[model samples]
Target: MKQFDVERPGRAEREDRPITTTTPTHRLLPHPRDLVRFGPHDGAHRPAARVAVSVLVPLVVLATIGHVEWAPYAVFGAFASAFGRGLPRFQRLEMQLEAGLVLVACVVLGTVLAASSAPVWLLVVTIGLVAGLTSAVSDLRRWSPPGPLFFVFGLGVSAFVPATASTVAVAGVVAPASLGLALLASVAGALLPAGRRALATAEGRRWRRGPRPVDGRRTVVHAAVCLVASIAAGLLSLALSVESPYWAMVSAVVPVVGSATAGQLVRAGHRLLGTLVGVALAALLLAWHPGVAALILAFGVLQFATELLIVRNYGLALVFITPMALGMRALGGAPVDVGALVAARTADTAIGVGVVVVVLLATHRLRRPRPEAAA
Candidate 1:
């Protein structure tokens, strides 16, 4: 096992350390990558485990989507399988899932007690799954913020599916199938004795460093906020546009505003410029050939190639994702106007991205001189 030469930073030096833990908070800040390295101790996944998750999760999703009548079961099957596979070695994964379920249960129970609303039911997906996924892919070997993206799934399932006696009965088949598939992969990954030992000793002294305290609630709230804001922005643009309701002018974009004031401004400026560029290019290409499938395919290929380039650069990710997103709507088998919709969508995306930046700036308001942590 090779030792990590770099020192991990303490909580105080890290940017995500709570500035005001004494008060109630709603946002969780992300940690810098220095907290973890590409080593074995923290996020060591056997290639086999990775292969299972990467393959099975998607397959389950496709199944559930195809059987839309069983959306809850389908979604549940997809996520539970993923989590069960990742949980044994990562205690945090279990903790976050349990903690999230508990918190949401309290909220649901409280609502019931209040009697201010209807006798609504509750479903819960583990937020820990999203947290674990991020942790899995992220370079941070140390702790990252906790969030139950799965909770969103739970809400969707419960709100829409109604977990009744019949639903519970159905779950008997679904839960076991989901758990059996997910947990099997994790167990196999853990059983590889050579793999486990290698992971533990892979980063000796660096392995002993303190981990970050994850703000689970913050991550959940902010992620919800971003998603909500994007949806609203998309709808608003739709209302303002000359297009009809069915042609919502490409409103399904997710904005990536800054976490700081300056970052917000930069994000806004970048998106504005990027949108203008995309629209102009789209116009020119559309002009060249109004009925060009080959051009569209070429553009699609270009968009995917650019996504690979954006791996190390988030802003670039947005650039390529934006074009590809617009392309999906543009090339869909519908009687939609290609040029006008593209222009409108580009405009709407820029506006939504601007709103995201402004909101982040207004809220986080980050400043310099916080001092560099160990990255």
Candidate 2:
């Protein structure tokens, strides 16, 4: 894996002469239409096109997720390859971890809340707020999601827990279904071209190559900070919470550290804020329409909309992420929990962010970097 370096370039390289020997790794790939710009609304089509695409992709992909075999996966994979024909080889993978975490959290909470029967709703809520918060915090380290770490954390925790109400029927269906959807979501996140591609298309920008600019290289240090921070946040909150709050605090703070202090921190903050708001709104919606259909539509449309806004700004993505996570959690089954869940989600989000910020501050002080001159 390539990373950025901040030291001075080679003596000859700094003299403004071109480096003729560009290797395959250094070669610039053709950026998609949106990679060079921002704001998808600048496209000929409004953001509505994204929404339409989202609705269709999910229905189709999830049909596969819910399907009996791998044929759907093959067809979809082929189509995605064709669609992303010339995209970069290593597009930053974000949603993979997020979706996987959601699934893992769902499975874990399901096992907890639904052990004897389908009512581990309390655990579901706790995991949502906590894990979602953790995911957001992980961004601070600038570590993107979709890493294998989520799969381990999500699946591992649940596996070790007591097995009761997570019956064969429920486990068999829920595990496969959740795993399938996680895969579909990753494909969508990768293939959709949300960040740079979306930006380029929005501006109709093109590249006239010049210098190969450097990127952030504090990743190792940042990641270490985030991991320590997450555990600290989890422990602190666990001690503070009395009833359900105990689980909420314990489960939530890891994602912050998981991201390890790159741009992920900003996105995580956005997601955490959105989740807080979403959880509150979900409570209201639950009060009004507690049926499964209402949740399905609410989550579906919001996911589509979130993707649209996510193309423009990170804040918008969180609006939908919050609710969708809470909704997916219902896989463990529903409960009469609207108010407390939302409140706890808000609190947990705060804890995660606070922990990440503190860690970042401490780390910065410990390893102070030389200040760069302003242009």
Candidate 3:
């Protein structure tokens, strides 16, 4: 209700500022404390609760019906609600609708690929395209989480897992149903007294700000970068025989979301640090092998924590994200080789992050103006 932009800290205030390049040395090593610092609450609980409920309800229902295997589809659909946070009611609704449609499409597309037993090469190419297209769309729409991380995640995971015709049909129904619930949950807050007050205030009218100007060139460049990074990471991961190559692909796209080289490095650092710590946490949780109900609860709690910290500190949020992802894979009926999974996750992420760093550094050097140009 407070109209918080959880994507980037102070995004609104910084929107008009140009992205200036910084020297690599100054940007490479972020302050250690910055990695662990917590940002203001900024009403994170509201969206966190929304996303958790949106995700948990569907999982609970799937478990009740003895169809928990479909939980992945449901969870991805619910991801729609995670977008458009902290916007005015109507604008939020619009953004969520757009996001929901994209998410559902990804699930359906992934399901189809899974049912057909698409080859790994095809999966890599397809998800790379998805990443590029979604990156463009996300930038055009000014999505907070910005970039195609969720889109690639949903599509790649769906494609990697085995499925059949019946499962594809199930995904079609369950994903939309879950998406519908998420849309409702996103706006349900309007019924509350605080929400109503917020709606009546100037903050609610901010939607009248209208959309930002379209920067076609910027969008295209970013999309191309995402496409190339994903493909490179995916291919390299496969070459290394990582169990989950998509993880590398996903990691490659993370750094590209930052507005500048320095920001990119910071994001890359967060992704690596958070993931490493999260792998340890995931190992413990997988070892515990909690019951169905307990797993569902843990899923909800992790989702909540992820949303709460994600905007404040990307690295910290990843601590929960790593396990949440592994947990989802387990719920989807995948063979859980804890040792192999953990090791693969670490290796794949490292490879992905390393690739982006190299790419970024190379590009930065190329783009740097020579001394003669400065003169």
**Top candidate (lDDT):** 3
lDDT of 3 by residue, 1-375 (tens): 233322332443232211222324224444555556665676788889999999999999999999898888999999998877656766777888888899999999999999998889889999999999999998888876678989999998889878999989999999999999998998787778766776676656455436567667567766887898899999999998988789999999887864456667777888999999999999999888877788899999999999988777888889998998987767755568899889999999998899888877766544333567457
- Residue 301, model 1: lDDT of 49
Q: What stretches of model 1 exceed 4 Å from their correct place?
A: 1-88, 95-187, 198-259, 262-311, 315-348, 364-375
Model 1 per-residue lDDT tens digits across residues 325-358: 3443333223446677676656665656655555
lDDT, candidate 2, at 21: 16
Point out the higher-scoring one by lDDT: 1 or 2: 2
Top TM-score prediction, candidate number: 3
What is the TM-score ranking, best to worst? 3, 2, 1
Q: Over the full model, what C-alpha lDDT does candidate 3 score relative to the true structure?
A: 0.81
In model 1, pairs of residues that clash are 28-218, 36-141, 127-148, 127-149
| Shift in Å, residue 101, candidate 1 | 6.1
Compared with the true structure, what per-residue lDDT tens digits does model 2 show for residues 1-375? 111111112321211111111112212221222122233332212223333343344434544455312211121221121111112222212323334344445454545543544333334334444444443333332222211224223432343234665343444454545444434432443334443354344221322212343223333454355445545555555556622332233333332322123333443455465566677766666677544545556655765565455435545556665665455444234464666667666776677567656665555433334345111
TM-score of model 2 relative to the true fold?
0.50
Against the true structure, what is every candidate's RMSD?
11.5, 12.7, 3.8
Global lDDT of each model?
0.36, 0.40, 0.81
